[model samples]
Target: MTTVTTRTVTYQADALTMVGHLALPAGSDRRPAVLIGPEGVGLSDVERRRAEALAELGYVALAFDLHGGRYLSDPEEMLARCMPLLADPDRMRGIGHAALDVLRAEPRADLDRVAAIGYGTGGAIALELGRDGVNLRAIGTVNGLTTGRPGEAARIRCPVWAGVGSEDPIMPPAQRQAFTAELQAAGVDWRLAVYGGALHAFHHPPVDHTALPGVGYHPRHAQRAWRDIVGLLAECLPVAE
Candidate 1:
C-alpha cells in the first residue's frame, strides 16, 4: 500500500513570504527530492496537487510560491510581476535557492538526489537555478523555453528536458532556437519536446481568470509531458526500491 503525507511550508524569498506545498512519501527513509515551480500565476491547487502526486511515488516534493501566497489570475498582473523577474536571472536564482533550502532542510529529502521541474515562469526559474550552478540530478521545464545570459548554461551540471507547444506564440521558434543554441554551445545534455498543434500554456488546465490569447490547455499533450518529466527523473534521479 502507498501513503502520502503533505504539509504547508512558509519561507522568505525575493522580499516576499512564500507559502509552499510539501509532500512526502510513505516511508521514513530519506528519498530523492523534487522542487516544483509554478506558472507565472503563482502557486495554486494545480501545482499543489502535482507535488502530492510525486509524493505518492516516493519523492519528496515541494511546490514553491512566486507571489507571496497570492495567485495572480489577471494576465496583466501576472506579466507585470513576471516580466521583470524573468529578465533578472539573479532574482530567479534567488527564488530557486530559497525554496531549495527549504526542501533540503526537510528530513525526508535526500539533498544530493534532487531534481527541479517547473512550468511557465516557474520553469524559467528552474532553468535559472541550473544555470546558476546549483547541483541537480535533472532539470525539466514545460512551456518555459527561456534563454539566459551568454555562456551561463555552461554552469548547468545535469541533463535538461524542455517541453513546448509547437504553436506557442510566447515561446516561438526563434525563442526556442536561441534557448537550444545556448545549451548546445554550453555542451549541456539537453532535450526539447515539441507537441504539435498545441498553444502556449497548453499543459495547464483552463484557468478561471481572464484568458490570454494563445493560451489554453491541451489535455493529451499535458499528460504526455508529465510522462516525459517522470521519465527524466526516472533516468537521472530515480527513487530507490
Candidate 2:
C-alpha cells in the first residue's frame, strides 16, 4: 500500500484551483517530488496511473490539474482550448512556477531535489520552469513544444530530456531540429528521444486518433518513454527508503 495524499490547491494567485494527487513512499522522509502537468485532456487516468507508478517506485509524485473539470472529447475541441494557452508562451511558465511553489510547501516534499514533467502543454511548462531557474534538478517532456524564440533557451538551468514522436505533425522535424539547436547553443545538458511513428499523445490511452489518420500510437515508444522518465527521476532523486 502507498501513503499518498490528495488535495486541491490554488495556483496563479487563486486564478486557478488545481487538483493534485501526491504519492509518497511509506515512512519516507523528505523524498523528492515531481510536479506533473497533465496532457491536453487535463488530469486523466493516464496521469493518475503514472503518479501511482511513481509512488510505487518510491518517489513522491504530484499530479496537478490545469484543465479544472473540463476536458476535450475530440481533437478539434482539445486544440480549441489548448492552442491559446500554448501560444501565450508565458501562461504555462507562470502556472508551472506556482505549482512548484505549492509542491515545495509540502512538509514531506524534499524541495532541494524538486523536478518536473509535463505532457504536451505541460511539457512546455516544465521547460519554462527549468528556463526560469526554478531550482529543478532535472526535467522531462513528452510531446511538448518549445514556443519561445531561439535565444530564450539560454535561461534554462537544468538537465532536460525530451521525448518526441518521429511523425508528430504539430512538432515536425524542422521544429525539433530548431529546438535541438537552441538547446545546444544554450549549453544546457539535454537528450532527445525520437520515437518512430508515434503521434502527439502517445501515452494517453483513451486518445483515439482515427480521425486524424496520421496520428497513431506506438506502444514501444510509450514504454520507453516511461522507462526513461523513471530512470531520470531515480538518478536525480534516489529512493532512500
- Measured against the true structure, the TM-scores of the candidates, in listed sequence, are 0.98, 0.90
Best by lDDT: 1
RMSD after Cα superposition, model 2 = 2.3
When summed lDDT is taken over every stretch of 10 residues in candidate 1, the lowest stretch is 201-210
**Over the stretch 175-238, how does candidate 2's per-residue lDDT look in tens digits?**
8987788888899899999988788777666365335545556777889999999888877767
**For each candidate, what is the lDDT?**
0.93, 0.76
TM-score of 2: 0.90
> Which stretches in model 2 have alpha-carbon errors above 4 Å?
1-14, 208-213
In terms of TM-score, which candidate is strongest? 1
User: Positional deviation of 5 in candidate 1, in angstroms?
Assistant: 0.6
CA RMSD per model (angstroms):
1.0, 2.3
